[model samples]
Target: MGTGLRDRRHGRKDGGGADGRNDGSIDARDLLTDEELGLIRMEEIPGKLEEIKRALEEKVGLGVSFDLVFRVMEFGTKRTAFFYANGFAKDTVLTDIIVRLTHLDREQLVPDTLSSLLNKYVSHIQVETEDDFDKAVQFALMGSTVLFVENSGAALVIDSKSFPVRSIEEPDLERVVRGSRDGFVETLMTNVTLVRRRIRDPRLKLEIMRVGKRTKTDVCIGYISDIADPRLVESLRDKISKVNIDGIPLGDKQLEEAIISKGWNPYPSVRYSERPDVVSSHMLEGHVIVFADTSPSVMILPTTFFHLVQHVEEYRQAPFVGSYLRWVRFLGIMTSLFLLPLWFLLVQNPELKPAGLEFLGPQKQGELPLLIQFLLVEVGVDLMRMAAVHTPSPLSIAMGLVAAILVGDIAVKTGLFINEVIMYMAIAAVGMFATPSYELGLANRLVRMALLILVAAFKIPGLVLGVTVWLVALSVTRSYNTPYMWPFIPFHAKALFSILVRRPILANKFRPSITNPIDKTRQPVE
Candidate 1:
């Protein structure tokens, strides 16, 4: 029982909430402070129903928090109390369970307490016994209906948690012309089901780990058991278990930071896919999928640069069509990363322009410096992108129209920017959008900006140094100790070939050895 709970915050540090001093926007009231999550007694429930209710109320803020509820009812001579969060278990579901409990009397529950209630009284699917009082409270807070019996040693946790979620729809970012419209939602179980339905393998395993002590967010590590390397699975499990954060407010985004250290690095170590089909495909290739509760996207483990640039849409088309699409996409990604800087370099040293193409640099020098003009346009485009995202859907199209037709045209005529600058920037912008992965696109944008700055400073040598540094950084970087550049640096000839060319489904027989999967062959060669 949690009756003898005391305030243990006296010796505790002042700033448990991530140093608590930096952000002025953070309201002191909202955070689950140490004083708030006081230490509770983990002893067995030795006391009767009334005493348990008092202890539970003090511990769980049963009446204090309007969303938390505790119902006391007696079936014949046996006293029972239902503890659950109001937000999770609906009144209708509770009422139905209550009707069932009414039939269970003291006689049926006398000899065996916890077992009798779980077996006979509760007819629900997810009922289980928990002895620790704190754990029972934790489960209730996480949306399970906990039952406390008179002087019972353990509590019956009925998992009837129905999270508030939206209808399954295609993800805005990962949309495709010819593919499944359904996408993963914020609800963990729903997302799990989506992936499980696709795999349909008995070997498919989902190991659940509770992260963030205060938040207690459910993080599921999904992988195919027999196929996935035990070392890889354990490695992922080990990293997630070591996370000692208080809460993950931003869901998977924050959890990712815990697993992978990104100090000013824009490139994502793991690929995130909202589509279950995309995730299932990865699992088949022996990659682990990390699903954090309240997050729509799931992280695909140990990804490469190539993995981040590709999408499921490529597979939807014919082999030839897919190959062509992939090549064009690769070209766009290259253009996004190099086009602006190369053009700027050419402009700076007009002598570098080839004999055939004298029009490589801007025709007319604008009032602003060429570099200034390029930077201004880049910042302006970024602002437009941000504005489009924040604006209402109906207004977004109109805003885009105004920016394209009115703003770009006006800037060129006013000599604020050259026509060539506007043209080249627009091409670069198109290239950025052509990238399938949003994170990768943003990363490429940052790399582009860095390249521009380097080019302005040291001319040809700066560009060379910048390129060298970028390649070396990526080459040294690892995703779960797996090569980020993979195939290219490690030089897997077959794998590199597969990446360059989208081989037909039947043509590929072996699973990617990069993940070190236990089962290598996908299909036996004829």
Candidate 2:
């Protein structure tokens, strides 16, 4: 029998309180450094139960006062205990389980009590025996119910986990005109199921692992076993396993940082998508996907510069229309990144201006230096964006009106900003909004700000230097050994051409070589 019943039978002789803490007090320092407890074997179930109960009390507060529930039940003469977190485990399911267990006949509760309960009494579809007491505790904390029977030396884990998630709806960030309105929710199981529903192939595999020592957040790696490179999968799995953190409260962003250690690099190495179709499309192309619990977004690995610029809307339309949309988006991205700096450079060196493009220069220079005015406008645009996010939807139009009419008109009239500055800035802001990847857009904004500073200090040379530095950074940066620039820096003509012009789905018969997919051919050439 476990020490729980032994201790109870012996009348609490260990000087511990009803909550299981020794001397009715535990040091906060001991609870915080509980990682030292490590893995507990099945043989140590009795002592382990006491230690876990004490730890739960010290760390999660008194069990009775907290959401954690530890209930003791009986199956004929055998003693049993149930452990679960309140909100995570479904109340009706738990009630049903208890009712069924209580009705089990004495003959049903054989000598192999744990096996008997698992094979017959437990009505849940998902039930498994966990030999490791530490893992059992972790599962119970994560929302599953852990059933411990006297002298069983193992616990039965019931997957009755339920997360408080909103209804699946269209993702605002990746909305499209003609596509599925379904989007990933905070629930990990739902997100994985969504992807699985789209890709029914047996090769599609999702490997689930726990991250964070304290949080034990569930992280999953999804990829097609045949299409995705074996080495790439191992490399990502290794990187994720090596992440030694107390908790990943921020989810995917924190996991990205841990996996890809890009020190001081502003460029986003991985692409994120909330749309299941988008994730499914990427997976079909041999890319690996990382799904973090509590996050709607999933990280697409080994993303290239071109990947960030593409959108699902392009594929939803006709081939020619898709190509046109792709080109327009590309132009907008380019304008967002370089239009202001190029304009500033032209104004700085009027001699370099072409014959017909002289009007590109501001008619009246503002009181402040051009650089300062540009910087101010950039800050103002960011401020307005932040304000709009916080402002209520009904009042957003009024906020926009105040910013566009009041702020811009006053700044120009007061000589704080030139008319040309406002025009170019507005255009740039629109281009930024047109960008598909929010991370990529923000990175471009940062790079643009840096280029503006460089252009203000030195005319033509600074612009050249800035462009060179940006290209060099891209060329050097790699996401899991795959080139960040891809096709462009390495100069693969076919791939580069495909990026410039959206290729028909039938024409894209081969997966990109960058991922080194095992199955190179996506489909039969015919």
Candidate 3:
């Protein structure tokens, strides 16, 4: 909460001002609370070993003990202690560190000597001193080992944070036939390393920071230093750093909401990918990536509507095949959005129907109005979807059977829904499932229902007005200042073509201009 670093001088009371001056009087408006202030102050180590022990016992619940590992080591006449979380710190690494520390000779062990021990003993690659006890405690909680010497004011922090994580496997959501099976895991370091493995260039930077006051959750911002726009990176960093929250338990989803701030907007502003290759591709195109700890999915920032609709499978196929696949997907997405509504419109105005298309309307109208039937079926479909999600894997097939046979047959036979409504709704649901982005699919579903209601109530004019409003909303929507409906709304021929048809890798010689990448040329001409 404090804006700047805490002064490390001895007995400088008045909570050393943010400007590093000993103001001698604590300001009432300082952001840090009294507890945080007390914990951060380490001008002097507690006079007795019992005092330090008592503080640790009270604050971190060391006495009551769960995962906290506390050990005191004696080297000749001097005594030192090490603290770390059991599950977070690797046993082998912690044992190696402790074994190395125990070998320290009496001559090397001087009273109140922190720097000498750090240089001579600690063999770990990541070791640093923390003047603040609060920060040291935080590091310990995050799985880093904290070393406390008998009389030293500073605590040595060893980075040994390893979390329980699943092995990298192909992401279920973004599966590809010919791509790498290695996907991101829940571990932050592992996820970052996955992206690093793909983009080996030194210019690719992954800046790490912590959010959440209590959780201190790690968040990484990745970008290509040469290609990515500096302003965009800095702006994203600024927005993330300013997030004031207790925790982000849902990880990327929560962070997305905090940053984009698009209230009540159904469309997703950022694209999410669990596949390292996909994230790598986006970063090369100058998009900034956000990786949150405990989340397998990383967010690709400043995304357009086209980005959400795209799938990794397209690139895996031949250019012509990919383009064909892309167009098919686009058709599916459009059908998901408009099929039901258009059918309703045609049914409402049978005069507009073509000569052979009279079979589109229901044979026998149900007891409920056509609009009511459509709404009820929509709600029923959503309920079935939710039920499927909650159902156990073993029972899922049985659940599907119940939904397909029992629900549909009973509804149609009882005159609650017509056969035409069931058939069309099922087709629409198939299209929705075909959509690449689940969030976008849901948004489309909502839009479809809205369009259906409008057409049912106010007829043809309502359908036109609703579509116009939808387009206007998308046109006005911005993702980190990048136009949401780029290429389509702004009329970029090349980009729009790229969206409509998957171009060969050799043909994509330039990065997207919308990102304002510093190096525009992805590849030089032969």
Candidate 4:
């Protein structure tokens, strides 16, 4: 494949130095096979209209796939080949473009036919010329109509991408009582529009670039030009451009994993948000957002432990109410992480219980050990969670009832679990469910399990060691150069105070120091 590509380049009269450019020494390009080389499509557009037509049919599966539509229409004396994806191309838009093109006379199709067509005839809001054949193919696959003019090196790409989109409804995970009901849709353009609509400022930059060799997924990086740190934006862009992958089937999730280099760390380095309002708020705070095509969720980078714990619901109410809610959430998160292990420790070492808190120790110790009982319940809860997801919507309530009433009652009756164990575990499970970020909740669950094992093996010291390790790891971990435990490990008193207490919107005059934003303040404060 390398040799073939080189031969094509060498054969082209326009290709300079492809013939005599270090022919002796074996280059690294020689090692790659056809599949390994990301560029499978022809790099240079074939000069002749017939060759371009043939290439489109052969390479892009024009005739093979029902959706990939190809047609040769006469524009004056010259013939033009049209490549468009059927479902993606808007029928009305493409028809209007073609109808407008049919008006060109034979005399009009003279020198610079492609230019004349683009400037005078093909009327569209978004259109561009593509010199690279592979890129042109990608454009066509993305639902744009590519016009291959006879003997022209560049193809006239008409942006007529009209993807099938779901109605903009509130996302299931990030729903709030008082907020915009419309959340981000799967469409990249629509998602950008949603964000853009909220922030009408010209400094709100949304730079798009395609990633994935096979999928060629569209990725949009959004940030306020004046507010966002240029260094951070550039760093993130470089990392994303360097992502070497065949496809991003899982969209933002896969892209996040690829760029972040998160090996075994269960904790999320970046925050994911489906709510546009939430995203806009983050952008204003000088955080950069990554929007991936075919994904409803977008990634907010330079995230911290507190970022994952936060929710839009807190801000929906009064400032004091929001602060109260924030503290409650903080408590819930801590409860999820420590409740199980602390309960286990107390039951294991009854002497550790305080004088008045004698009831904290389990009065009922069944045949099973406390550790085994906790582990069983943990696994059982996970199983039930998975089952709930797969189960039909109508049956989910019934399934939950069966698990809570039937399973729990039976297990307790059969001595598989003690009453105190079930009660404590239930409280811990509720706390886990209260977490805002799903990824963070899951990560906390892993930490909870680790803590449980540690407590079981080494008691008090094990729990301490587990927590210390978690904190130390977070202290060391960086998300796009921003510390994972920012404002806490480094101890930023002002920032930490603001995070702890959700201040009024106008009160938050300054942006987060973690992002190193160019503009420090949102508004002037007297």
Candidate 5:
């Protein structure tokens, strides 16, 4: 039998309140640090046990169990016994332990044996003290059973946790036509296993870290041991270890900023792709991968400017077709960015046109400069985009239609702006959608306008200078100390074939050489 007794609250009113009150009534300011406070204990063992139970009930507002006592039976042995009426498990291991100790006697019991027995039978371990009541309650609530024992100032923990969980499925964002369909889920352990299953080499390493002060997000860095450069891995580990935040709401983005060399640049130094195949491809290339606990997107380091322009679809198909598609992508990028601006400027700026091309559109009736016309058209297109993004998905299409056709048609006909201006802006707007990632497309759309402003202010000379400076800055940037513009500035012959014109996978015999990868080959064994 146990008697629940409340211990006297002896700390100063100004001290750290057990229930989070700090009204300053108790002069607890200098009594002891929490480290020292956790070591204090009362001389009376049973009384202390009762006090702990009472405190737990008061603090957590839950049923406290302490009735069963330590039993000494006929055979020179001892056991702590409790009567559980929950009908949890009749043949369970815990039930079996309770039933087997019937003939034990007190003579067999010793301090060392008791410690060993508890450790051998218990499923969980937790250190407990009067000061750590809150933490103990948290563990108990998480499906751990807590035990308060007399004479022993600690609590016995039993793991009996069960929770509903979903089975893993192929990633929705990264569907493939002919590869393993398995993908990472929201679970951390499962994600690690997915990667490990693909790379069975003993040298493959998965380094884990806990970030997010509140979310406590689990992040894993993976690389091949014999294949990954040690210095690069160490540098990556150092960066991830330094991130301290309340919570990383966007897990992939959080890691990107941590490892990104050009954090301020609009061009993404780190590429995030959902497909494990893409990640594995990057890993083999000596690029480091950062897997966030929550987001399915894996951040691949040392990603170059050209990688964003290429697609996984190219590698899935034939070599000649892939090269043709890569060239098409280059053209698409040009169309997406400069098409509208050039179209608008050529038709509107009479000064830019050679004599015969002046017949392109209505002779300029307005006094507004070409720059002002572009700015106005850009603003109109932006308003339409903003409305589309914020509107409901079904309604977005309607909003887009209205903006593109209704308002735009009216604006042109009434001469608020030239029809050519609307046509040019519309082309640029469509071109922005050519990139795979929505975020990257949005970035290019923005940079194109800045490029437009330069061209409008100083024509082709200004455009050339802006593009040159941008490329120069990119060449200097590094991701995890690996060059951002890989295979381009370093000028790898094979990489140029793969990047600018993606060849057949068979022809792509060598991995990206600019990343200074530990291993330089990714050829599949025949």
Candidate 6:
């Protein structure tokens, strides 16, 4: 129940005055209590070892090997000694320790002697002072074995840490044909190693922060110390320190809850991606990255609206292709939001239609209001979408096509809703899926309904007014204090080329202005 040690200087590698007691000289007895001492398995060491072996069975439980050995040395001979580890073959690093233990003087043995040998010989030994059973179990679970010696007050703990894990592989979610294929794994240490390999500068700091009350999930904050804004980094740390949750299964939800001020809004406040290249690019630009253990995705904060529309693969590909895709995406987004509702308003409200397109309307006659007819179509589309996502892929596609085409044809033929209105609604419903992020697509769908209502009430004037308000909101929002509508509304002519259409890596001379990194330029020397 006691608070864990909080002196920030304790974990430092330097021989500083604050951590003078951390010279591996402190007695193990001084740190442990009698209750904790009881958990030490001196008498039951053999039995417990058997229990562990029985549990692990035929698996690669190589670390669970514990056996009794006799040591004979020049000073004296010991009757019994404990050897616990899985992979200590004749060629193993600990094999020499087994051979040397045979000659040690039994009468001269002290708790400190065993502890000193461990600190000197073992690769990663940690001594726990807490006597709680749960705490001891946790330490063992992490691949460390605790040794209890008979007629001794202090227990000797050795770091026989070994566990089989998958090698680093390319991330599945975020893929680029041209970039590095390496991806992060569930292990915190492995993830850190991956980042360190990319950015070797000492200034690239990785500060560890643990979230979740019980999950104790390790979260690392990565940022360039010299390039990053000091205030932003500190603020990010403060927010992370405050998160109190039972569990955080995924890093995105936990970080979103912690840092986002307007999470309730449909728009994303933080940018998330699984690519290390994208993350590295963000860190170079003064943005802080929040990486959660066990999650492949990393969160970069104060993200602007424009960042959502972008993909890292664009820069890696050809410029003309990137520009075409960007324009197509833009057109698709506009159509998704306004196409159906605007069509309904133009076709139904005779006062709002422009000169040319007015003649294409009303193949079917209906007494129902235009709003009512459009609403029915919208509801049907939503049901189809839900069914599609829940059902098998092939079946879902068939069902969606059948429901949209056959059902609409039947409804129009029966004069249940206007034929022109149903066609317009179908066009808009299909267009809404153009946004890459599923959540973003859903947000636009919801917003489209609001736009439709406005158009229904005031016709074209209402649609214009609603769109203006939406643009104003986007312009005001900040991504890590940078303008959300960067290079567009503010008009960065030189930088605007990359936003509207991505250019080659060499063509980009300036780092993204939105990142606000300490170093603004990112072009290689010719």
Top-scoring candidate (TM-score) = 3
RMSD of each: 8.5, 9.2, 6.8, 8.2, 11.7, 8.2
Error of 3 at 178 (Å): 2.5
Tell me the spans in candidate 3 whose CA falls farther than 4 Å from its real position. Answer: 1-43, 111-113
Candidate 3 lDDT over residue span 1-526, tens digit each:
3333332111113322221232211111222333455665554445455677788898889968888877777765677788888888877887887787777777776654688777878787667776676667777887788888776777788877778998889998888879789999898778877777778775666655567877767777778778989899889877887888998988999999888789999999999899999999999999999999899999998899999999999999999999998998989999888988899999889999988887777788898998898888889999999998899999999999998889899988998889999888888988898899988999999999999989988989999999999999999999999999998988899999999989989899899988999999999566
Better of 3 and 6 by lDDT: 3
Better of 3 and 6 by TM-score: 3
For model 1, the superposed segments whose C-alpha errors exceed 4 Å read 1-41, 90-92, 104-106, 109-114, 524-526
For candidate 4, write residues 1-526 as lDDT tens digits.
Answer: 3355444222223221212221211111222233434645558898887788788778877678888877888888787888888888888988998898788888786888888887878888666787878768866776778888877888888877778999999998988989789999898878988887888875666655667877878787788777888888878877877888989988999999998887999889899999999999999989999999899999998899889989999999999999999999889889999988998888889899989988887677698888888889999999999999999999999999999999999999998889988888888888889899999999999899999999999999999999999889989988888888878988999989988998988887788888888889889456
Residue 454 error, candidate 4, Å:
1.7
Instruction: Name the lDDT of candidate 2.
Output: 0.81
Candidate 4, residue 383: the lDDT equals 96
TM-score of 6: 0.71
Residue by residue across 276-305, what tens digits does model 1's lDDT show?
A: 999999999989889998999999987999
Q: Would you list the C-alpha lDDT of every candidate in the order shown?
A: 0.80, 0.81, 0.81, 0.81, 0.58, 0.60
In model 6, where is the ten-residue run with the lowest total lDDT?
15-24
- Taking all chains together, each candidate's TM-score versus the true structure is 0.89, 0.88, 0.91, 0.88, 0.70, 0.71
Model 2 TM-score (2 dp): 0.88
Residue 150, model 3, lDDT = 72
